[model samples]
Target chain A: MPRKSSRPTVATIARDLGISPATVSYALNDKPGVSAAMRARVLEHASAIGWTPHSGAQALRRGRSGNIGLVLVRDPEELSREPFYSAVTAGIEAATSAHGFELLIRFVRGGADDEVDVFRAWSHQRRVDGVVLLDLAKDDHRPPVLEALSLDFAVLGHYSGPEDFVKVTTAEPADAATVIDHLLERGYDGCLQLTGPFEYAHEGRRRELLARLCAERGIPHLHVPGTYTVDSGYRAFQAADTSLSARPAVVTSSDLIAVGALRAAAAQGVAIPRDLGLVSWDDSLIAEVTSPSITALSRRPFDMGRAAGDLLAQKIDGRIPGGSTIENSPAALIPRGSTARP
Target chain B: MPRKSSRPTVATIARDLGISPATVSYALNDKPGVSAAMRARVLEHASAIGWTPHSGAQALRRGRSGNIGLVLVRDPEELSREPFYSAVTAGIEAATSAHGFELLIRFVRGGADDEVDVFRAWSHQRRVDGVVLLDLAKDDHRPPVLEALSLDFAVLGHYSGPEDFVKVTTAEPADAATVIDHLLERGYDGCLQLTGPFEYAHEGRRRELLARLCAERGIPHLHVPGTYTVDSGYRAFQAADTSLSARPAVVTSSDLIAVGALRAAAAQGVAIPRDLGLVSWDDSLIAEVTSPSITALSRRPFDMGRAAGDLLAQKIDGRIPGGSTIENSPAALIPRGSTARP
Candidate 1:
């Protein structure tokens, strides 16, 4: 490693350009005190010598700092085992970067009490321009708190009982409705729906739709209490096998769960589609990336992220004019080797 | 919606305790300007009402602010598509948190040219106590500058040349050796190793070990480049089958790569252990959680994270006497259903 001459600092830039250190700070901040000519000179000298402001200080002064906070309300362990959030986060970054806004991502351990502390601190301290909130429950504490504070926010995959908030999500019961209806039309006598925890807004809808539609068509189902992980999916299949009168064709709330069902089926010497039909949610890179490539209802998390960022930007800029609502971005189905009639 | 009497701000704490704002600031900073009795009074009042110092204001103070920085050389797309770095980072966080240190993570686009600007600003501004540098290349530019300016750091994976640096990583070659030797002992006559990009330090070592060990054992085997994702792994296997003298009976490499290989084998109508035996590296939760539960040489990332954090903490506290190094924590062989004799 070669040692080169030390690069110049703000002080060096000020000295070379015949300006004060305070002036450099003001120019960098785009503050009112610095004259246009002086600001240009400072910027030029700083550019040549390199002047980067302490982002924290800049953030403090300009309340509209280019920082968007991301709060993921999920188990940390579960998150690592799943890829949807990461892909969505990546999408959010894609949009945020276009506007030079930094995403200040923090995970909130979502047991009611912890989420409160996490939300309050982040929102109250003005640590973010807005937050991307995920997994809203039916009676969400966060929505009320955020609404009260009037914090700019965009919810991902959760929208119930709140029309005043901005949300970027895929179709909920709509996708489930479509998949379930497809199952019924195929003359599947019985169905097993492996869903994420009931606390999850979307998964809850999936269960309700499966139950309601299945009842309307007079078909029975075993709703397995599962989370959005492969393990949960596998466990759900095992639970279904134990509880069901006979093995039923399956549907999962996530592709991860779908994969698990496939594994469980294979393990039990059950054939896919031939013996057990399966359909899942969030058809992502993982949908195509799996064996037999399970059929799934997929949404572009990248597009969802971009839309969320745009909506949050609208709120941040006060363009939404309050109490406005964006309904939902729908999900599309991608068929593969998995779904088949019993 | 109720404010709950609001969180005690700097002003609120001062007013409630009947002390000057400056005195509260002084007490918060643990500066010598405040008397012991006054400090205790401030502490008592603040704790009763939960008055934490604002992180933004605290970061503004010059020098040794107790913040650790994480520099990721990958793009946002990688952050989502690639789980390896996320696991490694989660490990780093495990270490940093145990020592009561905060991590400030940032992403740098492209190479060292503009990145040097980012690093210079971070170090000179004392934005972090130390940096954890990842993705080292041949003729790395970071180490020399870090030492010259007296910045604290922990290098992940590897360093360029012979420079002494504190690093925490799995012994990839040894792990590879163990896996290969296990496959050979399991009555497999031939094997295939799907590896990450050859330029990467971890993948390079694994590739070399697999090749050398195969030669020494006189085992007929082949190596293929894997993109460290399921899609890539599948493609690599397809390409390898065209030129191979015989189909590989055992497949191994990094977990993600192995996952791809597993899919490819399945796609080509190959049966596991019967037609091919499979194993993987890192043992990330996904591997254990995957179908057939990939047999793996477990790196045990959580413990690795804890170890990395311990070293980083010692280095931060000035306890380590020299360049940071820790003994191999030993990789555990996690045999799942993926590997067996024909």
Candidate 2:
């Protein structure tokens, strides 16, 4: 590669024009103090000199980095394996790019304290104009840290705090109601829910909603705690299958877990939607391609991401106040072969 | 949110110390010329006042942004659907975060020109120290643009150009050789290779390698152009099935396409591995969970990403010379039910 000349700075242009750097800065930035002709002359000279504004300098002056941050406090293996985070990220990228902002992502391998440290650093350094938060747990500590730091942000999950930031969520109770209604309509007598970690706020909400809905209709319901992985789903299904007298329709927190249940049923020689019924929480390609295509709640994660991105952008620009809520379309159940009971 | 006071800057510390800002900068940065006692006094006072170095100012002085960039020139829908990009990104994050560098990602919905424009803007602004380039096409224009900008970069695919840039690649020829060997061992009479778009350099290479290997072995080889999507895979399989006289074993460029082909076969009553053998080029969850789990070549994209990240980091730090090449572990064929013909 050819060794190129150093980039031209504001001082370089000022030196060429024999003018004060302050005058050039004011004229180039279109500040009010500079006369129109002076501004035009400064711009022309700066253009001729091939001077591009330094982003660092520009960010410092404007108090905006033109970047948005996303910190994922997830196991790297889990982050890579799950499709949910990726789709949401793509959606966020779609919206942020349309607004000419870049996404700065950091993966935290450690616990919540390490995640908080990242936010603190970004806040102090002004590395991003704002951020988007994901995977809200019960009493998530991140919101309070971000609030104390005065960093503009939007959450992708429900937060129960008094001080409301922008939250983009799917209708949780409606999701549960839809699932129970579908199961009852299919003539399933009992329901088994394979839930994600109860530490997550959404998981707790889903459990409570499902339990209440099942009780009102006099349907027996069982709750099994599991992580969002295929192994978790497989084990949960095996444990449920052996322990229960009657096979209940299985509802999983994610498609991965549903896939595990499908594999387990196939291995055990149990016919799906006959001896067993399976429903996945988030629909993706995985749900559609399984031997017995899984009935799934299409949460539309990409749209959720787009909504969160737009809200955060608005929050960053001070166009919208805090405590705003935008509910994405409620999760709609797409029944496939897995739940096709005759 | 609390109404917090503004953050303490260097000037604030200087004002509190009744010293010149330059002296404070020198003391805080631990530069020579400050007396030991004076430096200690300045440090104590700065710590007492909660003064932190502004990242913008520090970057301006150091000419490093403490960030790396990755640009994806892909359809947003495609990006969100494919697990490959996400896994690769997660791998990149693992490496970059380990080195204390953040990942800056920008998705370009347009063609190559728009992608190049992102590079130019990022270069001019010093928004990233170096970038990782993906999906190199025939006669790709991006390398030339990045080279001209004097930006340090690493390519994730083969770059035939003479200028030595770090490249992380898999053994394309070996991938073809192994697939053919696997097919022949399974007693498949003919081969139908469903490929991604020919515009990509790797696709062209794979096609040539497969064609040559098949010709040498006198195996009837057919190639169909598709994309890294399930729908494309479905359409390609349907077209191939109707046009061909005898059903040949199908090999797809990605798991999504394989899933599509599987769906098509199931719809048409073509028994997998018995009537038609199926293999996916990239192993993923979709491949593993399909009705007859797909036989696939595990490309280990995450490892590829990690390699690319490490190379780019080294390139940016000037630790390694240009033209460095790192070949990831060869793609291994994982035999599953899809190719278990007796």
Candidate 3:
């Protein structure tokens, strides 16, 4: 293998071909200024001499880093246990790598300030060509900051900011309506919605929609706020069980929460679908494997991530992405033993 | 906010200060050539102008990208389902971000060739200062390629190749011995080891150790090889159940596989611990929450990841990294209902 310094550079190729460095560069990069014959000659010579472009210098010249950034503001413990984000990440990786871009990920332990700081640093450094944003919060501070920095980005959820920002939305207003309709169709008298943190925009939107739908149907709706964790789900279930006079059908924002509720039900000797019904959002392998297997809304997180990646890549390449809002396949409710009883 | 071109570069700062760009760069970068007063003045002026280092230019000048890479070669379906890799990623992120480095992750869908291509590209582009490798094969081809490219990296598992490679190992020979001793004490006359694919170095080591231990103890040892998925575990269990004259204590390579086994056992109406004792490797929330809560050997994957990130960072910074082998906190066996009878 050639040593670092011994590796052929653009300058070496230019000198070997007895041409101006600019002409060689334009030819090698396939710019319009170079003639077809000159371009072919430069390409042949460069290939023969083994001249690979230095990514850093290329990034500086073109002002493109060939990277897509993803900054996740989440509890590390919560992130580790939940399969939702990982699936999304896998999808993003699939799409980005296909487009010759790498995924630059950062996990912020702190709140919005830390997340914004990351965006600022990335923007100033030109570390990434574009970013894919997740876990958007109600009154999110990131979009405005990102806009101010003139960085191109795509959000995974609804962004209530500029009309131009690309969004890949899976959760719709109809999602909560479907869950409530399922509960009502199952002959459930009341509903207990175990939501993810209220700070999240999706959770808040879900809460509002569920409340409105329940009110319309005259179903008693009780909301419990918790993090996206099994322990949080367990505690929320226990709290609802003791506070309410009757057991209500539980609808969780995430499957981990549903698993916790299942554990709680087991401990309390409350039979699933018989004594109480459960429906988990974000269906995964965990939902399918549990005893009495949970009823869940399958969102296909991988597809969502892939869409976001595609949108961001398009935005980076100066293309007006076909759609600002790419709607994912509608969330399909998979009825299992947990919601099998009518 | 300042427009992209208007943002102050070192040349702009130098021009404003009537000094050479080299002197400005030296002062800004804390290099020794510049005087203390000049360094202070440069810092003050740069701060006043809101100048942040252009990452690409800084990288070119310093020969550092300030990024660490992790390339995972796995099925996307399996990656999404299993929580182990995600947790490791979270741990790595924690350590890398704390040190002002970002994590660049790539998931390769194909085998060794695809993975090597990624390494070659990354090395050629100078994209990452170092990388963290996972799921090493017995005759892994990555290390030699990385060494040839002169890329700095750390392995999460054992490397059979060179002695100079940094290895952060959580699995040990004694891990299998412990499991066998537990099964023997539980009066299990035979053993069924449901292993991950034989390609992984860890699985091969684990299989060998289990085989040797079972031979030494005069117990019948049966090995079933499968992927690290729930379906694999379920099928392995079914095959073993139908083939074996007597039910043996089953030990799985992963929690998802164990969950599949538990499901199969439930389907077969086999009473756990009494009819068949089961222990899962790589304890996770799934293990703790499964029906008959599976007994498992808990390897803290997050800690292992953190150690790997630290090692890679040190290696990139030109430090010998104190120790070549970082033995993670020993895998602790967390006995649950599956082994409660014994």
Score candidate 1 by TM-score against the native: 0.85
Clashes of each: 3, 1, 0
- Interface RMSD for model 2 amounts to 3.9
lDDT tens digits, residue span A1-342, model 3: 122544477788789989899999888777889889889999999889767787788788888888899887778857878889888988998888888898999887787788888887787788887788898887787776777777788889865555568889876676777787887788776788898889888888888888888889876888999988889999998888433425468999898999999989889988888768899987987787678889898888999999989888877776765347788867888898898756
Residue clash pairs of candidate 1: A283-A298, B95-B309, B273-B276
Ranking by lDDT: 2, 3, 1
lDDT of 2 at B332: 91
lDDT of each: 0.67, 0.83, 0.82
Task: State which candidate, 1 or 2, has the greater lDDT.
Answer: 2
lDDT of 1 by residue, B1-342 (tens): 112225477688788878889998889778989999999988888888767544555555533444566666655555565566666666676567557565555565575655666567666544556777765665677778777656777766644465466777667666767887787777666767777666666666666777788888887767787566667787888888533424345455566677777777778888776667788875765565555667887776545655666787788787784466775565878877777654
Model 2: residue B17 alpha-carbon error in angstroms: 5.7
For every candidate, the chain B TM-score is 0.80, 0.92, 0.90
lDDT string, candidate 3, B249-285, tens digits = 9999998899889888888988898878899878887
- On TM-score, the leading prediction is 2
Q: Give, for candidate 3 chain B, the lowest lDDT window spanning 10 residues.
A: B1-10
**Shift in Å, residue A59, candidate 3:** 1.4
